[model samples]
Target: MNKTDLLKSIIERLEIDLDMIQRAAQTAYETATAEENIAENKYDTLSLEASYLATGQARRMEEIRQACKAYQQLTMRDYDPERGIQISNLVQLEDAQGNQQLLFLGPEAAGLQIGTGPSKVTVITPRSPLGQQLLGKFEGDEITLVLGNGRQVQEVVSAW
Candidate 1:
């Protein structure tokens, strides 16, 4: 799949997630303030606990909303492979065994994967270990990744 197709999929997924989060957040907020959750005495903390849970849910919902907004507002730029890797670039990497993975670097939405088959794209941020290592690497460059006690080598096949 092309970048446009992958980007559309990502936005669609984010919208779905945002809707679900809003619904869940509303439910949690309502449940927390419901009469059944009211504290009966000084020792009663059920309502307080529910309120805390609701707050956390609301916070998470806000975070997801922000992420969706950031993604939607991203300007698609034409990237030159020779310019090296950067956010908004589609990169192709190959391992020693010839296994390949397509990655889309973005400012947000890290760990979000889109597409299937050979067109599958995994979203990564610069803060991630692999993303950090891939930054500034040109095509045909080999990068050594350290994972715990093992090391794996991957080559930058292409970037667009």
Candidate 2:
């Protein structure tokens, strides 16, 4: 999988999310200001609830905008095996049971999955527990993951 293509996909997804949020925010704002929604009494809070929804939507929109900016400004580069894994690297890991997982280390938007089937890659941020264990780890290195009450071990199969 090409890193450039992956980054492009991420940016595109973020843009789509931003567009949806903008529309929702606009609708919420309209609902909040509509004459029909105006509070008729202390017990009637339709307008107030709409306003709160609008505010939350606005905050979400700003977050998506910032995420877009972050992804756009992200620098994509080839990983050096000798230097170990880092952000922008696509890593493949194999668990003790031989199940392989593909992960893309990114600066943000963790848990976003791109592509499908074997070509699929899950975005992970350095702050994530598994991501923290993978940082600076080279191919063939073993990393342990704590899941619920069980511990699983995985080996770095490849990274680039």
- lDDT, each prediction: 0.84, 0.92
Question: Residue 124 of candidate 2: its Cα lDDT?
Answer: 94
- Looking at model 2, which ten-residue stretch has the lowest summed lDDT? 75-84
* Model 2, global lDDT: 0.92
Residue 132 local lDDT, model 2: 94
Collision count of model 2: 0
User: Candidate 2 at 160: error in angstroms?
Assistant: 0.3
Runs in model 2 deviating more than 4 A are: none
**What are the runs in model 1 whose C-alpha is more than 4 Å off?**
41-45
Instruction: Kindly list the per-residue Cα lDDT of model 2 for residues 1-160, writing each as its tens digit.
Output: 9999999999999899999999999999999999988888899998898899999999989987987898999998687877799988999999988999899999888888999999999999999998999889999999998889999999999999
TM-score of 2: 0.94
